[model samples]
Target: MEGRQLQQVLNTQRLKSLQEWMQESSITLTQVNGQRKYGGPPPGWQGPVPGPGCEVFISQIPRDVYEDRLIPLFQSIGTIYEFRLMMNFSGQNRGFAYAKYGDPLTASTAVMTLHHYRLPEGGCLTVRKSTEKRQLRLGDLPTSINQLELLTVLRMLSDGVEEVLLKMAGPKGREVVALVNYSSHYAASMAKKVLAQAFKKHYGISITVKWTSFSKSKHVSETGQEDGTFTPPGLSPLPKPSITPPHLHPKPSLQDVPAHPPLQSFFRAVGSPAGLPRDEMKPQGPVNRDAVSLLQWMCEVNRLGTPRYEVRFHHASSDGFLCFSYEVLIPCFLIPLYGVIQILPGPSVQATKEEVYRAVAELVIQTICKVSNARPF
Candidate 1:
């Protein structure tokens, strides 16, 4: 019995040494792989084949699902390194889970086979690759805010927002919340700081930033669906037009106002105005005193149009351009031709202002050209 115990001890020590060696070698090999990829494994996995590191994400899961029900189903594709189903405060399945696999090939195989596989529950599952990059979600916001207001506040946070998943907390028990997913954690952190400061000043609400993940439970209240942002309100549902309707909402009439360049003319070959009269294309007066009201219509158009343009500012006089810091052109009818693009507006500014104007014109023209091809705006 003593000799047997001694042999067992020796075997344990040998296994420990092998594990330590493998760990060290794996680190070294990872370093040598040029950071982007690995050159196989130095010693490689001890199994019959090599494995690649990959993570899989699953969504649309039924509420009754549990980890036990998933393990067997996932094991058929490849060995699972880790499995996690996001949970809510009630510890219920959030209807989404992430599984890390030993190899990308195996992960791919699993995704292909099980993307629409029906579970014992009523819903089917959707599977895809997991992103190491986190999507930021801001929660605990006051429910009164709208998406435009939310986006304005968040833009103060960071310029790195590739996309944002924004939400307003539901009424009743629902909290006003916003989720801002940035391209990087560093970006997310900076956004939290900037938005916190801006929100306090603008909305008088204290904003909390969180690395947002989906709530585990799929069940949501009707108000939650409306307010929580799982399904954002339709474009028309935004705040109604505040502008008093134009005494006569300008119709596309040639008799009253200049004929609009035909949509076809604008989209035709470069520099081609089709056959629209040039004199008619000139400014039709300073967009009327109802200019302020016209802005609301522009905003509405932006909301409904693809490649939307948010109205940032309006410039009436050239002095307002400098005093109000409206450095850019008015960007509406008549202003581009009569205001900014007009020759010798002022010699007081920089001599290179002409060059700057040319560059800006090029950029604006390119943008218009590209946007014109889109559905609208």
Candidate 2:
């Protein structure tokens, strides 16, 4: 048992069982948006919401280390108003977390004292003040949205809304964009995550919500960079929009039309024969194909060798959806297609990985259909 415990501590990638973790940690944690929380405002605590400098970001943490060890360690520096450990789906820490103190002074003390502090296991931690931006930029809003109406809707969707300013966007200034300020960084962060889906579901309109740079009221371009990223100079202009080829569209005869083409869910992994849960990351249609069966069919159809998948989780969208970049190497294709797939974030990373495989399989069928359709008789 001692050897097992020691190995668990040493294996940085090991995932701990929830039962084993609960026995070791006393703090009740709630998981959301890929972070594990322990008291954003701890129980029996009453004071103003923590502002800037009240939180410290800690990194280089060992994966096996959980809140039981971390919370107590930071608590030594000062009263911990909150401690959030970024968690992995497989029960390991994401190697970084944030700790909010009761005040700016205590948070500063944590960084001064604990930056580069050596752990008992001989690993060093990097601690610094958390950089939490408290503004969000909303685009694709109704052209007629007034400040009062948008504010009313925002308050209904999320808390900590301080102010809203509408801007005329697009070349003709027909589109409306809004900049929103929040009372606290946490509120802004949470709002950025939920607002996108909230508007779409409740109002049946798609809107983009992302962290904004208050450095300036807006970007030089009227539309501004999307997802909070700036486009550098000398980049090729975005490709002209082209109508999707008819063959690429979901055909009833193929028996493998993809679900959620925008999300690139491809075929969207459906349940297998064993009563497995269907992948409802998005609303999917009837399950006509699984990855394995689809891949086998693709191979037979193309007379190609085995297919290969090279994929990695690249980044998370501003609204908390996970994005993965993938390269599908097919023996028949001279150039393997590279693409990005966006998936709704969830606890199971492995399951998301499997979904990517299914997506690739469905994509292969689409590509072949397009090729076959284009060939001259």
Candidate 3:
């Protein structure tokens, strides 16, 4: 068929161009784990390690497209500190990559200028800020493992192992766990995929890896701030940070959520759905959303699991209304989005909790909308 022949011809041309670039030494190519790293701190590049917000997450890449085209496109915005193209074993991109610019300004420019930019093959790319977490919580190690020995073995097994801190985790602190700090987010992503399996295959030991809810640098003492309030490790006192827990399910269900803990609005009095005043239940502005379905679709598209929330109903304010705040965290997403919502709860505590759930669900749909097109309900 003509289409088959045309595809072959295109592949041939791409292969030829890649070969020429290699021979000319215009780009460096190597394999790290399963990725075909195109240029890391590219050739003749004299620049310090890129700072936070310098990298952008790129998705929906066409499989056949290579760095032969992507690098130059991004270079138009600013200097590319590093670019990594994820690849499949069969010699095509896995349809996503990461690009870190020389500075946050340049990276922001690239996201604005190039997101949804159409490729020659007719697929639009999704580009956004990449999340950076330097530390990974590694669990299920041998009890007798020593810090120095474990550190050395980890350096051999994982790329960019800056250092490892050992602590006891499971079952009365009988298991050894390691907190691994990587030099870059790219390194952590790469290591997360393999550390467990690598440990099993090579060392005959098994382990588990997780993204720590709070980075080591962010962890604080019980008496954290100058204010006398005792801020919990992951959650702030009020109107600030809230602790979120990741789900363990590989494919989480929308209905598979935590028990509904009813919440109340501290500052405003809202009656139950049957008797609550209409003004309190509805927002002043026009609103529309099919939150439950959209959340399920989003989870499917981005490879995320069902979200888990940390809801708290606080003591009543002086105005005689109960207080409430909720934190929603969806597992398996690179982006750690924090959703904020302010809405009147229904009269009873249960109605308020449901209203809060829907509000936060819409917030999630809005937050991820830039990274994903809203599919029709």
Candidate 4:
């Protein structure tokens, strides 16, 4: 047993060691691939080298489309090494993305096949090999404009805003420089035109908007530039509408009771007076006449004084007594039955004619049993 246990422990240790070795090798392989990709392919790496051909730019993506949706769509053509859907800080899709496939051939095939492909949800895709070495950036935005306002203004004019970076240009951080990353080149251009016009008209200042090449070394400024030269244009304020007074109606007197008297009488009849016995109030026979009459009246009122239920007394052979069966129009009888049961104690009675019949039968049985038990032997 000791030898067997030792052997099992050794096996477990070996398995763990193998797993660790595999993980380390994977990390090393990934590092090698990264070096080759960013730097250059290693010595003796054969055949037409994989360049930007392995990466494809997809545009006109719907706002709802995310990385998960894009993966399945492109997986048919190639294995995705990297899938990224650019999103703003608010987590909204920027409507464009870059997907890098495992091989250049696969990437090229995907580009050709998916280009101008109409999505079921809406929008035709514009797929192509990404040639633009730098991401498009918009500059010369008002420093006074915050990220939210900038996004709103850009969205009003363009399709979507991917990112926004603020910086201070002049000495002592006096000038604010806002850099915005738009999804597509066309969207960026459109925003530039629209915003330039808007600023010129609203603020009476010419806002310079231009695209900048992507740079890894370029870091977004942490602090905003406080420049008094130009103030950001605010949204046009609207005048608040005046509130209207609600119409009031006079309370009806007791003499006007005929209109709504049935409902009031239905509730009053179901409830017992202070001196009344609770047990005697059970629906056994003519003892609960008030309750029965009120319930019937309520049903009549509901059906416009028409009888909506058929009440029949069945003779029970075993008990030698009559059992009541109520066949009622479900909708018409339920409203009053609900009010009748509310005044009674114990479990809540169901709003059904059959339920009412069952309750009445059970009450009769209990009353009979109580009287029989009360008699002397």
- Leading candidate by lDDT: 2
Cα lDDT, model 1, residue 365: 42
User: Cα RMSD (Å) between model 2 and the true structure?
Assistant: 22.7
Each candidate's number of clashing pairs is 12, 0, 4, 0
Give each model a TM-score: 0.28, 0.51, 0.50, 0.26
Candidate 2: worst-modelled 10 consecutive residues by lDDT = 240-249
Worst 10 residues of 1 by lDDT: 219-228
Model 1 lDDT tens row, 1-377? 97676555344443454346546544231111011112221122322112223767778876555554565578678776556555443334556765666678888899999999998746898887654433445666644444543443243334344333444444554665555544332234345445555445433556565443335422221111111122223211222112121122222211222233222222221132558654344222223323322332233334521111222122335543321111223324333311222233334333223333443333444444475663212
Instruction: Please list the C-alpha lDDT of all candidates, in the order they appear.
Output: 0.42, 0.60, 0.59, 0.43
- Per-residue accuracy of model 2 over 60-127 as CA lDDT, tens digit each: 88777777667878999988888878766566677888899989999999999999998885679988
List the candidate 1 regions with Cα displacement exceeding 4 Å: 1-130, 163-174, 201-203, 214-301, 304-377
lDDT minimum window of 10 residues, candidate 3 = 220-229
Number of backbone clashes in candidate 1: 12
Runs in model 3 with CA error above 4 Å? Answer: 1-10, 20-25, 170-174, 197-203, 210-377
CA RMSD for every model? 22.2, 22.7, 24.3, 33.0
Pick by TM-score: which candidate is best? 2
> Over the stretch 317-365, how does candidate 4's per-residue lDDT look in tens digits?
4544334454433342234212111112213212233344435433433
CA shift of 166, model 1, Å: 4.9
Better of 1 and 2 by TM-score: 2
